[model samples]
Target: MLQCGVAIAAMLTVAPSMALASADSAMLPRNLSPWGMFTHADVVVQTVMIGLALASLATWTVWLAKTVELRQATAQARERMAALEGGASLAELARDCGEASDAVARLVQAAAHEASLPGASWDSDFKERIALRLERVEAAMARRVGQGTGILATVGAVAPFVGLFGTVWGIMNAFIGISQAHTTNLAVVAPGIAEALLATALGLVAAIPAVVIYNHLARVITGYRALLGDASAQLLLLLSRSKGRPAVAFGRAG
Candidate 1:
């Protein structure tokens, strides 16, 4: 009789723990990894993640394309500046530089055209007119080279908010779920909370690099514009030096 009573007591002690273990196990998330959380996340949360990912992809693409573009363009502009410093006449530089579409070439072309105008030698505002043309060309070149960087700025400024929206929506959904299930168990609530935070994590993932890349590209573009400015100054010097040789800056070259 006493042995039977001990067995009954042992079962009573172990039974609730066993049942509770089973309940806890049931509440635990099957997958808590990032990819797992994403897959199991609410549809709205998933959409936010996907958008942030695309933003990140755009950021990286801009980085790669702009890096290559700036490298080649800066090198070319520097070479042209070196030529400008050599005091090559605008007419000579025009033919030697080739391709009037590049920034430096266009500067030379603009000066050449302005200097070759009728009565150019007698025009008291000759250098001033050429300087105006060079300035316009420089502004246009800066705008062109900076074309794609705007997207980076946009992403950096907006992505974190996008992620926060996902998190808020997710946490809201989690609370709704907890209310419906009529429980405040941590096990029941953690998965949803974790999944929601993942969106923010992805947001940071998309934003930080975008901000960094934008700043870097800005610096590169500033350097390029400075090079353009130097070239313009050199062209003006060439014009001043050619005062004794009037045809050098004022007449059309065949």
Candidate 2:
């Protein structure tokens, strides 16, 4: 009988404590979704997240713009290269090319201008001059096409470290909160830890695509450069073959 009474007293003592804990649990915030954690994160962490998101946005934007530009440029260049194979003289080729502002068109115009110079005898030196003009145009066009790609390289190289900084800052804040709260409860610390990791995740998300895109763009640019080289070679061949022909051949397309 005494033992039963002692057990009842112990149960009575614990009942109210359990009820109070249940009340506190009900009052605590429960949703731990990513957005929820982000919304509740420290200001510095939030800034880091926002910056990373912007970087990712920039990466995709560049990818889209460069993709469109490369596709059009490659198509035009291929068409012009095919035109070079037709037995069209420089004058005829220029006329057929119309007033297109493409690099190859400028190349044809430069060769014609050099040929038309009164001093331009259809000699080795004349060919050299024509080659030089085409080279300059090629270089200029390549630079123009590659103008905005540097940012992708910059983002790829720096984004991870930026995220790391945010993660460190967030973890630091979490530790401070742990000190203030004087508890090792997972509930108290887990959200901050998760927020810190989210920053790192965002950084990787921004960086990886930037790197892949930069590399892909670089390869496409190289192929485009090769097309320019082939065009230059074909033009030089045409100039050389017409060397013995009448001055009229050089008249339009030296």
Candidate number with greatest lDDT: 1
C-alpha RMSD for every candidate = 3.2, 3.7
Query: If scored against the real structure, what TM-score would every candidate get?
Result: 0.88, 0.87
Q: Which number leads on TM-score?
A: 1
Query: Can you write out model 2's per-residue Cα lDDT over 1-254, one digit (the tens) per residue?
Result: 99999999999999986775565454334667878878878899999999999999999999999999999999998899889998788878777766677878778878887877776677668788988999998999899899889999999999999999999999999889778765656766777788899999999999999999999999999999999989989999998988965554334432
The regions of model 2 sitting more than 4 angstroms off are 1-30, 246-254
| Residue lDDT tens for model 1, 124-183 | 577799899999989999999999999999999999999999999999998987887567
On the 0 to 100 scale, the lDDT of residue 123 in model 2 is 68
Superposed by TM-score, candidate 1 places the C-alpha of residue 127 at a distance from the truth, in angstroms, of: 0.3
